[model samples]
Target chain A: MHDQPSLAELLQAVKHFIDETASPNLSGHPAFHARVASNVLATALRDLEVRTANESAEAASLKTLLAVSDGRSLDDMNRELCKRIQSGDLTATSHGLIAHLKATTIAQVKTDQPRYSGLKTAES
Target chain B: MQDFEAAAHRLFSKVFGAEADLSDINRLSGGASQETWALSGGHFEAILRRAPGGVRPTRPSAAIGLATEAALIRIAGKESLPVAKILHVLTPKDELGEGFVMSRVHGETIARPILRDETFAAARLKLPGECGAALAGIHKIATNTLPDLPSSNGSDQIAQYEDIYRGFDIPHPVFELALTWLKANQPAPIDPVLVHGDFRLGNLIVDEQGLAAILDWELAHLGDPREDLAWICVNSWRFGVTENRVGGFGQLEPMLQAYADAGGAVFSTQEIDWWEMLGTLKWGVMCMIMYEAFRSGADPSVERAAIGRRVSETEIDLINLLEAANA
Candidate 1:
């Protein structure tokens, strides 16, 4: 509604410029840093694309694991989970805890590193 | 800005005791704490490890100081271990601040090439056993002959990580869980020995023949020998080829057998497994620290920011390790 080139599009355009135009002219550490900058932009774009759904999915899983439906933020819920685990109220063998941990972690990896080899193995 | 060339010339004159033609004084890549420069003077070529800005040497909590590091390298060399020979440690007269110069041993330090390049195919096959044998030599160094090093115990180590994690103020449930698991499973104390804390693929210089020189002793500490063995086998160090467990070079048997064969203490697979999990968590915490550095503007490297994302990789690995053990 606001503009034709959305946030993701703009980021991609900038990343393309860095990768194709800016990088070739540079050499040594500058070139290496330019490449890393491009990768960071790519990750930022990926995060923007996946952030909302990933947060919701994580929140849903946390609700099921913690058995709460209150409107706590995802960060708050994760902190609560950590507290429980650390205090020994919940453990690795706790009911549904490992499943929740594994599922949520896999979801994170998907958002952050879709090409990570462990993704396939962790899924099964 | 300090004149690097003039400083290098002064350093060369002092070490070689005469002026010689020095060239190709280029900085090698990798490592953030210490600056490494490769320079050749006349027939002499060496790598200089120096404190940046000519100030006092700074290192992680566990490191012995640079003077001690120089001494340790000398001792390791005497034992016939494949270590860079120490040529000179900085003296006040040198005016180059704190650090040491060592004779450069040529090989590959980059992990990807060592794992994938056709040039190192033969080296890959034999590296694990050689690493194990080398570790045996490290563990045998007598503490009495060494400078006073802070001996780290399991509880103190975990407590230190806990402190650092809290300081970061970022709640990582996975890391908290790992900390709990580590605390619950703290290994019974063993006789502490010299641990090459960062003994992984990057720290080892690999030639076509095999490991040419063991480098980067900054993280060297007095701890369990199993810490060294397990750290090298951490998943991240494998550089994507996870199948070859021993630093992505080969299986565990050859390494372990070579260790035992070389008169090193034989540890059970379970022992190594425990240490490996700990190693994964430690690496994750270290990554988080890098992020904190990035956040605080101390280090503005994109690499550090990217490495922050890698904490999740360790999370997945931690879950798998714990779940398998629990099962």
Candidate 2:
């Protein structure tokens, strides 16, 4: 593997610099952009921590929901799920549809924005 | 930049007087094509909103032109609705561009301070009702007397946003589900009125007393008035205070009551709920549009890039709304 600092650590360092140093020192649009940059880094770090497990879970859910045995990529499975929903084959009342959507969406929000109020509402 | 300042100076001199001295001219936050500027001259304080580069190119294809926006503001002001008074609509002779100067309304437009700060504790209680009444006033403006504007009902909007979403060609299962729900539950048509297409926290100016003014009429159009009511209640505009649904300040019932008190058409909770779900989906699609713009390098700012990730937040919200509806 690479040297001491992991990918998450490197991202955290950049985020720290932006939040603690760069953002505080700037003003106006630059300052706002600095904060956004820090947020981007934080999101990156979160995604790095959870991406593998989340993607596998999402893939398995999609496979079962779509009832496919072949090894389709996650993107292909997701596109198929969307097509089925769009075509009226899958619906809110359809078996396992809402469950799959909820699980997938919650997993995404966990990485995208764990603190979003919708997560709390969805979990409840 | 010097030329712009000189032109603005001349425009102010013509309007305020030959002796009018322009100072503190600062460009405020706005889109790339649109510009909002704050300026003052002695006792004269006003805001300048314009399409920079001296041409009106209707960028989004939804905006009623600057002149029409000014007219709407003037008409709204005449109806005693809280809005900035339009002072002057620019002429070709003014040479500054297509825009208008208006008496600045002093208030906070930022969401956090208005939602959470102790300074606005009193205003928060009154704001939801005030917003309801203001929206009632907007919807009541006789559409026949207004300038030609686009109009759309529920299905029309669904088609419009769906078309745009499809254009992106990215399959969002949640968005597809929302589309299905929206189509299956289209609200019955009503006589279309002047709908302030974007009536939310950021577009409202809240002062110590309450809502001082409604700004940003670029998205103004003719549609169902419930669209305005539900737009405010959308969770995205709640700014984290999701419990109080009406713009994160108060509950929905009081706001609906205030709207009725001010002569707006009474609406059922179920009716408004439909529109709220639609509003959430619309914002999600809008986030996708912003992400596309960023990805295409049209406006490659960190802000635009970050907004792309916010689509998941909308997904979670849609899931909650759907679950609640199903329950």
Candidate 3:
């Protein structure tokens, strides 16, 4: 809150350094790892940008799907959703289940790998 | 490093004779479980696959050991399948640790180039048939002659991956849904055959003629042949060219036709869809496992940490597959 550069800005600067400066100077495995590091930073930046909204949306959908109250944390609700799915209480054809899974997973892929081909496939 | 090179040289000299001078010994990268070294000697080129420092680390239960890998390659070669010929299996006397030397088969193993590069256009056309034929030959190998290998049917694999997922102690509703679907739709057990558990693009060497060699026998096991077929069609292996379902180069129809023509069991697309879904779930769980390894400091690398994020890709893939199935 007291800094010139925000967290996202700092992450972007480091990612640019890796992609534009550090990576080109490396070769072979080191080069590959530099690219991966850049990707990791990029993913972090994306997650930071979207995490709050995505989490709240995911939690809201999970509450609807699980018919739970608002007091539970997202982690707690997700664990309940997982238990229901695993225990056969919820299923592929369960009401609002596929929609919830699709929405949640797509949001996650948007942050984790926005360019992943599966994202297009999932959305379409 | 010098000691490793000297030992390797001596081993090569002993195997290929003193006249076969060894040079250009370089450790090829990737693969955390095993080390692959590319070496040239006189007119011959070979690869050394070994465990580091003569000590074999405990690998996952799925992996067949290096010696067994060599044995499978030898058997596959005898079956006239394209494989790197096992030049020598190391012994304690060799003092270079557990490994085998194989005559290298040259080709591109990277997926993107094989999928998009014009250099592989002709290879791409012929690959599905060739891959089918290669798998046919592998599946036909008499199991009695094979070294003792673990075997699993569809349910076994589901249980295995589910156990692994449980071990990670992370909750992903998508994974839970996938597990539920996989269990409900488990295919009936079939007569086990030699299944190349990792038969995707990166494990194959494709030149202009297509599929010069099939490498990485560490995951070789006795299981359903459909496991091999479906594995190649997994979205993860397709790179980005998702239209070409069979390793991002060919359609499923030609591959299945070639499989039958080559004396492998005939399979319909519907029959293998279950396996494809299972393969997707397995990869998603594997990504989680990689992340856990990184978190536990077992193998702290950016690559391992990055793979954890890829689980979402698989999750989305599962949703798509499930939606398609439901449709």
Per-residue C-alpha lDDT of model 3 across residues B1-327, encoded as one tens digit per residue: 887888888988877887888888877766656788898877967899998666786644588889999999999998889999999999988888999999889889899899999999999999999989988899999899999999888888898998988877788888888888887777777899999899988889999988899999999988999999999988988998888899989999999999999999889898779999999999998888778878889778899899999999999999999998889
Using DockQ as the measure, the top candidate is 3
User: Which has the better DockQ: candidate 1, or candidate 3?
Assistant: 3
Model 2: DockQ vs. true structure: 0.68
After TM-score superposition, what is the CA distance of residue A4 in candidate 1 from its true location, in Å?
4.5
Q: What is the DockQ of candidate 1?
A: 0.63
Measured by C-alpha RMSD in angstroms, how accurate is candidate 2? 2.0
What are the per-residue Cα lDDT tens digits for candidate 1 across A1-124? 7867998899999999998899999876677678878878877898898889888988998998988877999989988898898899998878988888888888777766676655665776
Q: Model 3 misses residue A50 by how many Å?
A: 0.9
Error of 3 at A12 (Å): 2.5
lDDT of 2: 0.88
Tell me which residue pairs clash in candidate 2. none
Over B220-276, each residue of candidate 2 has an lDDT whose tens digit, in order, gives: 898999999999999988988889888889999999999999999999889999999
Please provide TM-scores, in order, for all candidate models, with all chains considered together: 0.95, 0.94, 0.96
Q: For residue B143, give model 3's deviation from the true position in Å.
A: 0.6
lDDT of 3: 0.88
| Candidate with the larger TM-score of 2 and 3 | 3
